[model samples]
Target: MEYNTERTTLKIPEYGRNVQRMVDYCLTIEDAEHRNKVAQSIIDVIGNLNPAIRDAPDYSHKLWDHLFIMSDFKLDVDSPYPIPTAESFVGLPDEVPYPQKSRKFRHYGGVVKTMVKHAIEMEDGEEKEALIYGIAYAMKRNYLKFNKDTVSDSTILTDLDEMSEGKFKTEGIDLPHSKSFNIAPAERNTTAVRKKGNNNNSKKKKRRY
Candidate 1:
């Protein structure tokens, strides 16, 4: 009996062993025209074996690339797409550069820092003040949500000043109270209170009856 160890290794296992054998046979064909015809047929079989392969952008190009890969790039068949080199599959991709700007407070995130930078650039006016207030309020709300602790208004003000290079201030601004941090919790409390009130009324009505 032919065991898996005795057989040739599959180049792309997704296409299965039979497809790999077909690719191997394709490389042996002397005539380029006949080899191209067999290659196309093999690609059709590959598409049937894995329908989701068509989901890729430039799917026909990708399929042709796979055909070449399965044949170990030995098949001299006419291809619709640029024939990928062995190095294309083997070589490492270029390194992606990381952002140079560092976050002052990671909890508030990079977006908040960007907002603060923009706020600093804006001319001092009513619009700037409104923006500063909104930023501060948002920071405090976010801080409370993440930390699950009461973050003092002063902390949010301090972070804003540091992030904005001491440009923003909370001296005259009326920021939302700590209770504003969790609207859902406040809503839940209100619901519980109303439910208690209804239960109490029901008990009183039962006593009267």
Candidate 2:
């Protein structure tokens, strides 16, 4: 028995050695008409190997291309579609550019940075102060959530000051303590819902009589 190691390497291994041998036999056919007919038959055989390709728009075109590729582009047969050349292949895709804008603090997120920038441009008034306080409070909450540890109000103030480029001062304003935010309302709501469901199920167990 002839082993693959001893045999010449197939151009396209997916077509198999038998298909490759058929392709080799196809190249040796003297008559152009007979070669074309044999080539079409060979395409039908390979095309059946992958019935999924029939759904494609250029199904026959792809099959002819595969035929040329299997024959090492030496098969002189009439093709309906444009025959591909080595030079026709486009190289690797273009590189995508990295984002220019980046957040000052990733944990605090981009929204906080935007708020800080907006606050810096705002007029000195009551509305701006409220927005500033809200931003700071949100920052602390995000920091706690990400780190899963309690943070001091001063740390939040210092971070807010540094991130805003010392434009926003946290001197007079006092941030709310982390203790209040420990128990999230969402968790409480979920627990309440589960308890209510259990009560309903227990009630359902009692007869309508």
Worst 10 residues of 2 by lDDT: 92-101
Would you list the clashing residue pairs of candidate 2?
A: none
C-alpha lDDT values of all predictions = 0.64, 0.67
lDDT winner: 2
lDDT of 1 by residue, 16-114 (tens): 444565677778878777677667766655554444545767767767777888777777878887787887887422221222235347556444554
lDDT of 1: 0.64
lDDT of 2 by residue, 1-209 (tens): 23223568766665554457667878998989878866775676666554566787877877787788778778988888887765554542122122123534766755466557767876776545756787788788667655545789888989999888998757787777777666354543454566577669878795231
Q: Give the lDDT of residue 172 in candidate 2.
A: 82
TM-score of each: 0.41, 0.41
Looking at candidate 2, what is the lDDT of residue 7? 61
Residue 207, model 1: lDDT of 31
Of candidate 1, the 10-residue stretch with the lowest lDDT total is 92-101
Clashing pairs in 1: none
What candidate 2 gets wrong by more than 4 Å, as runs, is: 89-209
